[model samples]
Every structure is written in structure tokens, then in C-alpha cells.
Target: MKISDNCYVEIHFTLNNEDNEVVDSSLGGEPLPYIHGMKNIIPGLEQALEGRVAGDKFSVTIKPELGYGERDEDKVSIIDAESFAGFDQIEEGLLCQIEGEDGSPQLVTITHIDEEEGEVTIDANHPFAGQILNFSVEVMQVRSATEAELRDGLTG
Candidate 1:
């Protein structure tokens, strides 16, 4: 079977950045499985795998827009340190959740600290945001997805 809308696909992949640094991989782990065409993976990768069959191997390079999107300067903010008082530590590189403008929870990474100013710099962009992705993928299986699985936004 070929990977297409409503199909189930199993793939093993190694994702790398422009510098060839390994960003993620299925090494020593089960191949990733997802319902094809359901936005289970990056848009560029999902679209590239369309119509591909099991045992197919290929490499695809995706731009930032189709990957995590270009990094937005506006997503970085400097906030008062007291907002994180509940945390035992306020070290940089810590991941924290803050209330977003809509009152929804937003995940942000601490970037800097200003002891004198009592401020902390945080960035809400995904870690991989603005980076191009180079993927080496091998399709393990491709088959029709069950009706129930499709309804649940998954593949079986």
C-alpha cells in the first residue's frame, strides 16, 4: 500500500540540521507510526511521503516555514522575575509554563536573567524554530487505516 490520505504509515527516520547535527532519530527505538495526511508530522515531510510505498527510502530538506517556521522576535519577552517565584529555581535554560494572552498555558524557555533589574528573558518559540530540517527516512509499512483509528486521529 502507498502512503496517502487515511492511510497508516510506519517510518524510521533521522532528522538533522544544516550542520548535520542529529536533532532526532528512531535509533534503538520503534519506528514512528502515524495516520498519513492527518498532520501527524511536519507538513513538508508528510507531503513528501505522499504516494510513497513501503521500503522506500529518501532524503528531504524542508525550509523553516514548512518545518517550525521562522523564529519570531516578538515571541521573546522580558518579564518580571516575581512571576516565577513559585519555582524553586529560576535558572536560565529552564522550561516553564506561563499564562498566555488568551489565558491558555504557554511553554517558554528561559533565556536570560537580570539580577539587578529583577527581570527574566523568555522565548516562546519552539527550540527548532527557524531551522531547516534534513530528513533521511525509510518507509517501513504503509496500509489502510481502520475507520475507528481514523476517527480517533490515529492509525491502527
Candidate 2:
């Protein structure tokens, strides 16, 4: 079956950056599966995979805009330590959630901690933001997606 908006696809892929560093991979392991046109993957990759059939192998480079999006300077902020009042210990590299402006939840990583100043630097941008992506993928399986799956816009 050809991959389309309501089809399920299984693919094994390796992603590398311009630096040739492996950003992610599924080659030496199980293939990742998802529904086509369902935002299961990056926009660039999904668009490239559309209309392809099982057994197809291809490579594509995704610009930052269609990937994780360009980094925003405003996404980084420093907050006083008192904001994390309930935490007994605070350190860098810790993942935490904060309320966004619209009352939605936002995840951020602790990037820096200043003990004397009692402040923490948190970055809300995605880790891969502002970088291009190079992907090599091989389609392993293709199947028609169920109506429920299509409505949910994701794979089971």
C-alpha cells in the first residue's frame, strides 16, 4: 500500500546533522511506526514520505523551519530560586514544567544554576531547535489506518 494521509507506515531511519553527528537512529533496532500525515514525524519528513510505498528507501534533508523550528531568544529565561519553592534540591539538567502564558503547560530544562544569586536559567526551546536535519529512511511496512486512528491523527 502507498503511504498517504490515513495509512500506517513502519520505517527505520537514521538522522544526522550537517556535522555528520548521528542525532537519532533506528537502524540497528526495531523500526518506528506511525500514521502518515498525522504529525507523527517532522513536517519535512512526513511530506517526503507521502505517496511513497512500502520498501521505498530515500534520503532527505529538512531545514530548520520544517523541523523543530528555529530557536527563539525569548524562550530562554532566568528565574529566581524562590520560584521553585517546593523543591528541596535544585540542579542543572533537571527537567521541569511551568505554566505558559495561556495557562498551558510548558516543559523546560534547567541549564544553569547560580547559587549566590539564587537564580536558575531555564530554556523552553526544544533541544533540536534551530538545526537542519538529514534523514535516511527505509520503509518497512505499510497498512491502511483505521478510522479511529485517522481521527486521532496518530498511530497506535
- The whole-model lDDT of each prediction reads 0.92, 0.88
lDDT of 2 at 83: 80
How would you encode candidate 1's per-residue C-alpha lDDT over 2-109 as one tens digit per residue? 788999889999999999999899967999999987898889999999999999999999999899899999999999999898888888898889999899999999
Best by TM-score: 1
Q: What global local distance difference test value does model 2 have? A: 0.88
Task: Assess the local accuracy of residue 146 in candidate 1 as a C-alpha lDDT between 0 and 100.
Answer: 88
TM-score of 1: 0.88
Q: Pick the candidate with the highest lDDT.
A: 1
Q: How many residue pairs clash in each candidate?
A: 0, 0
Instruction: Supply candidate 2's per-residue lDDT for 153.
Output: 56
Predictions: Cα RMSD each: 2.0, 2.3
| TM-score, predicted candidate 2 vs. hidden true structure | 0.85
- Compute the lDDT of residue 32 as modeled in candidate 1: 94
| lDDT measured at residue 43 in model 2 versus the true structure, 0 to 100 | 94
